[model samples]
Target: MKKITIGICSIGSGVGQSVVDSCKFFREKVSLIGLGNNPLAYGAFDCDKYAIIPSYYDDQYIIEIEKIIKKHEIQILIPGHDDEALLLAKNHEKLTNIGVKVLSSPYELVLICRHKSTYAENFHEAANYFVKTYKAIDIKDEFFPLIAKPEQGFASKGIEIITTRDDLEKIEFEPGYIYQEIAVPRGQDPSYNAFIKQLRKGNNLQVSEISLQLLFDRNSDLVEHCATYNTLKGGVPIEIQPYTTTELSGFIKAITSSLKRLKAFGPINIQGRITDHGFKAFEINPRFTGITGLRAKLGFNEVEFCIFTLIYSIKIKKLKLSNKYLGIRQVASKKVLQSRVISIKKEDSVQKNILLTGSTGMIGSYLLKQLSDQGHSVSRLYTQEKELIDNKKGYSITDLKSGKINLSNFDTIVHLGFARPNSTDSEIHSSIVNSFELATQAAQSAVDQFIFISSQSVYGFTSNGKFTEDCKTNPQNNYARAKVTVEDHIKSITKLSNETRFTVLRLASVIAPFDSNLSHEAYSSMIVSLLKNKTITLSTPNRLISKIDFHDAVDAIDHFTNYSSSSVYEVVNIAPNKNFSLLETMKTVAQELGKTEDMILTESIENEEPNNLVISAEKAEQQYDWKSKTSLNKTAKYFKKHLGY
Candidate 1:
């Protein structure tokens, strides 16, 4: 269990107040801290204590929140309002350090979604295919006794019940708010299934049993009212009208298909009201809330997934449901990191069993998780699997050399042993070459479709627009040359009627969460400099490079093994399309750390005359439907809080 620090930023508002009540979930799962002046909040939850911040816009909000994050040793901040959600996304990794995982989208998405008018336009464009709508707000007249809300407001803050134009005037008529057509009263509509069906069908995804409770403080006494499913006798109270599981599956798939383009990797809350025929969605939340935890308890754990990915560096392949109905009651956990390796995870009989080499390396470890999550029986190639019989992950290389390893039991193989194609040192190259030689032998025995993790540097230094799989190989360095040698060797073996096919994945420099990787260390160095108010020097002056998040890179290897095994005998590059010069990347690192950009100097590195290199993944996408999702900006921030610059 991971202990979390969750600060409710605007407890004065109803949504903020619910957060305090939500501490029932946060009691131990997350430490609840209030950041507003209102004691009138917390309609249902309780907390150990609350810290009243000056204001939401106060510059000191970040300063004080940072303090609470450190004090509680928290790993996640579950904001109560939309504003805080925006703030969380912008400062995810910043808050991520000091044990804070803020629930929000990537800042880029937030910027595009925060403005209602703009979002309405873009949402139509982005989701128009599934929704087939011209503009969401324009459809308000089609259905009424409807609700109207601020495009970016939260907790019914600027929400209005529009019986007429006069009611809209009560909320001061904001430009960002949009009047949405409401669902027909619980017994009157059927078309709602169109949207609900799309959302329930997805890979490892669980659609929420949406429940909307509206509170009215009429006169003095507060009353709770449920409208969506209030008319149903035994159905769960819901905002989205309930549909049969079979029907909603298609709905979930359609929506996610649209969201896939957005590259969503966090919690997304949709507010729906049950209509007479089905359900109507009123709003979309790109962050976590107590409701998400409710859905988690029922079947989906989006809350856990959110913290797992953004803060703990856990890559979520798909939503896992715990049918135990063991409700996810939030309790601040004590452990910051926890590992659960499925020793005997069984996949569906339909999915093929795949083989992965270098089963103990960091990249390999992650790749196994990817395959296992994708409904594949992932058996590790451990030299000591026979000795431990039960355990396949932690093994000894000595055992492998003793001829104890066997590989004749799987469908695909991922050769992911670490190889240094960029090392300037000859000894390191020889050692890396040795690892590859040994790994290939292990793979060749059992792998039907073998994939090797080769580095992008093997393409050689060049100024081509980008290096594709077809890029000319000019391995000037020993490391690159050695890789080229092995790729050629493997091709020859495959062509000679070997049962096993092979793929060589040329990977970009990967940025892992830890500073152990050079890219992260470089970024960390800049953050440290910014915090210490020191200047740093660099040498890779003008070299343009592409990078992959370590997890994403590993996932690409998995994709090759499972999906692209048929498209074999080809080399592929695993890298983001965006390329940044070494100096430019370092400066961006500085800017993200809230530092003066001038602190990092390109002049000191300009003399190095670095080579320009970027790799394209068109071939990989064409063959495996695989592409990198962790963008440059997101990768840079993973280490931002570590140095706290």
Candidate 2:
């Protein structure tokens, strides 16, 4: 089984602990990364690996989380507390950009559940079994012996019994404070009279409250519900049993159906008491209950079910219930090692706003997708008048030479649109004019940097063994000359404008899927032909080529864009160090596709083959600490699945 990293925030909380405990059962398949604001949170130590993060209210909270997600490559992030859950749900778009799946209720539903007053106002009828609830300000002619608690209070915190109107008057009525009619608990059906007698005599003050744990999917459809007869100790469920009554179960099902309209997801806990009249609900917690671990140990595992269903798209079979299933909770402690306390500080990193050109081009398109996935705000610049559909936010510059493009909102302008083949002298001049104009506009505007994508062709054909960034440029063709001209233009802009920095990246041949604007490359072409059951014929079998994967190309751009440097200008070469000959690459692709080397027609191959040019990225690695990490084995496997080879 493939292992995936899963992060649980506020893991010290009850809900987070439950999730961590459940993840332990799937240790073979899941790597749990626990996070908490407090060092004392037990879940932090209980998880496979733990870290102490700032509170959700902290300004650096999301930034730290993004760093952790990137470092650990966390695929799913589960918020354990109500506030964190709501926060994660609110910033779903931001987190999902990094491929992190957040399982949480909708923001609206979270609001309804976080405050008792809101839940009572919006869902009173559907939850009629609940205690008679009223806002403190709206408690007009209500009877005495009312229960008052904070509207957004968790557990039994901030609860007070109001026996007289004078008592209510003496207490300040804050917006978050609400009043409710108390419903005395009654015993089970057969022992109801005896329990009431004992309660009246003060001999027994037991409040028989049962907690109903409900599970829902992303679509807000209820998957299952478990009824636990809870024995509370200081507002915490201590002893629990899988107990259910027909009347109580019916009421819970109705409530679940009503909540489904809110698109509420994950586990929801409904706490209520059994009274002489009937089962009366007190409040609803739109999250995993405190008894989740106990319940999982007994029969059902909601965390596992939810993860499997949501992440893997696997359907879970209905869990078999057992009334005899029982579990107990006790105070358990683990001696903490003082050295394990990890203190986290905010790193010095700023968010970037990128203006990317040639978004419709092959490389640019991939770069745009990758940037967006990494939570960077990138705006696409188009030269033609294209309708912006699917809510793509960008600007269209019909005339780039006019210099009407807006560079005010962007911090970096990346130019990848200058390369145009089969153009006349006039068209070439127009492209050059447009490229220079755009660079000038960027340098003059508030933009901090201008990144020009140049080609390694600027080096011409290197006579030496390898070409480095320090090598003098010797343009051999129109395309190479055009790239060099743009590079020089950008350098001149940097000299004139002291505020803006300039960077030039001379990229080698990239091995990636060719889009409509891109030409078929040797690597991808060989793979595609193999998938189509076609043979490849090469006149020269020993033509060497140095190629970088498309992903690594994106990595190079990301590194420089995010690199905070004091230098005014820098030029770097970007390419893989490994080199492969045409025949060797063809045989590898064929082997990966389970085809024989005979599939490649090498009969016409000449004994002598041309040597390939080489470029080194040592400057990029030393200056920006950037290196391309691509394996031919992995790339081949990716192409097999990506192109159905």
Best candidate, TM-score-wise?
2
TM-score of candidate 2 on Cα atoms, chains taken together: 0.51
Q: What is the C-alpha lDDT of each candidate?
A: 0.53, 0.72
Error of 1 at 461 (Å): 1.0
Local error of candidate 2 at residue 379 (angstroms): 64
Backbone clashes counted, model 1:
39
lDDT of 1 by residue, 236-283 (tens): 222332223332343344444444455554555455544444444445
Query: CA shift at 219, candidate 1, in angstroms?
Result: 99
Clash pairs, candidate 2, are: 97-373, 129-281
For each candidate, how many residue pairs have backbone atoms clashing (under 3 Å)?
39, 2
Model 2 bad stretches (over 4 Å) = 137-142, 187-208, 336-339, 343-645
RMSD (Å) of each candidate, 1 decimal: 22.7, 23.0
For candidate 1, give the lDDT of residue 217: 20
What is the lDDT for 344 in model 1?
Answer: 30
| Over 4 Å off, model 1 | 1-355, 381-402, 419-446, 519-533, 604-610, 641-645
